[model samples]
Target: MKIEVTHPEPKPGEPVGAQYWRSLDEYADRPEFKEWMHREFPQGASELDGVNRRHFLKIMAASFAVAGVGLTGCRRPESYILPFSKQPEGSIPGLPVYFSSSMPDGWDNLPLVVETHQHRPTHLEGNPLYQPYGSGLTAQASASVLDLYDPDRMTSSYRGTRRITSAQVRDLLQETADKFAPTRGQGLRFW
Candidate 1:
């Protein structure tokens, strides 16, 4: 549950580097490093200068007992189970079915081969019918499916200080277009 605050967020597909160590023997390939790597652990790890096997086991058992009691006192998570009244004749539960589809991209439509599970679209890929004989999908087309389930995407429009419906936004845009009709946008500059 603890986080290392100093580590930066990694890029999406970047490979991680090896772990850093303080000792030079650990860094360079050394006999001591190999010995440490093959060290017999847990068997004698708890048997330090004072603590013996039985003493360690007793401490561990007590710790586990306390932990188990503490966990039981905490609230158990709630789970839900919903069963369908009737199953479909041909369709099998939990099996995915693929459907050919396409999404608009400017003037063109990118083909999609979507995987649907129990009538729900689960994943998608570029239609194998197009490009390099269905070799791969463009990054834009591949990433577009994520937009379908995006929770943070804007669902409404706002005008100035007030929330406005989509229709009102369209009307306002039209009114502005009319006002700027003959001017050819000479007075306004888009940043």
Candidate 2:
């Protein structure tokens, strides 16, 4: 058997050759040609004939499995919508609403205002009715909201050795006052 190769070039004033080989090197050096040869006649591993097909199929199957897993994982969680029992007169759901209130912390009772969205207080602003201490809500008032929400506040207000209610605290104050009332003229030391 014998094999021959040919090269062709376009002539002057003629349409350029759409496809032609310039040299045997051009055909042999092509990446697609090399890849096709590798797929058709792989060297040094005859067992790869069966393994390569199985490997290509396994890779494609795994790619589809990963794509399906990713799509199923992207599903969003379910959300529940609960309306307020008594919605405020001017408040609307999904809209920012402001309310005028006073922060009774002796630091300018400016109309402490807060912005609420969907019945949740999302932000706080200083009441302009009081003195303007620069811009938005003061650090103390902002921190007070965190303090109010803290679980430790109730635990910190207990009397030594005993947990007493507000009424019990008032009675204890009255008893201490009665004991001190009789000795008003005496110079007593607090220590």
Candidate 3:
């Protein structure tokens, strides 16, 4: 049931000044507000409709039964943490390996020194040896290494909603190139 509350109005000759009021009901001293404040909770706050003790017990019993079955069924997947039989040629177990590389931009490349731990690229820095583009990397180049390990990075090409293999993609590109070969890609649009 919706409770109707009315605002208190000032008398005609009463002085109306800036007053700090917490709530309209408290400021107006309404009977409904007084009744609500006297109770620990608002009406029906602690009530559950149509959920008796028997129904609640049945739900709890079913939940426990399902949980017991799940717990019994679950076993840790078989896995072995084996050390490498032969260490990589130039790798030391604890030492990070650095490789000089370049990040391709449109018409230019950003020289980079990539640091890897266990063959995974962990960090990237400017290639100090490259004289022309000094030992300084752009922000994009610095953070580009993250893309290598990104879990959501696309690993396969897709045509609409269907996944297509690399070989199929290559063949399709070749066929398109052959189709545009006579015109020398005159009608081709990159976008």
Highest TM-score scorer: 3
Error of 1 at 86 (Å): 5.6
Task: After the best TM-score superposition of candidate 1, give how far the Cα of residue 120 lies from its true spot, in angstroms.
Answer: 4.1
Q: How accurate is candidate 2 locally (lDDT)?
A: 0.70
Better of 1 and 2 by lDDT: 1
Better of 2 and 3 by lDDT: 3
Each prediction's TM-score versus the true structure: 0.37, 0.35, 0.44
Which run of 10 residues does model 2 get worst, by summed lDDT? 41-50
Q: What do the candidate models score in CA lDDT, each in turn? A: 0.76, 0.70, 0.87
What are the per-residue Cα lDDT tens digits for candidate 1 across 1-191? 99878878898878778778877877896986777667746346635778877898999999999999898688878998765688766567778888888777665667789987777776878887787537366678777777867999867787676889988988987887888888976675322
Report the Cα lDDT for residue 117, model 3.
91
Candidate 1 global TM-score: 0.37
Regions of model 1 farther than 4 Å from truth: 1-78, 85-91, 118-120, 130-135, 156-191
Model 2 Cα lDDT, one tens digit per residue, 14-83:
8764768766756668887676567665554555554687798898999999998899678688999887
Q: Which residue pairs does candidate 1 place in steric collision?
A: none
Between candidates 2 and 3, the TM-score winner: 3
Q: Which stretches of candidate 2 lie over 4 Å from their true place?
A: 1-77, 106-110, 131-137, 151-191
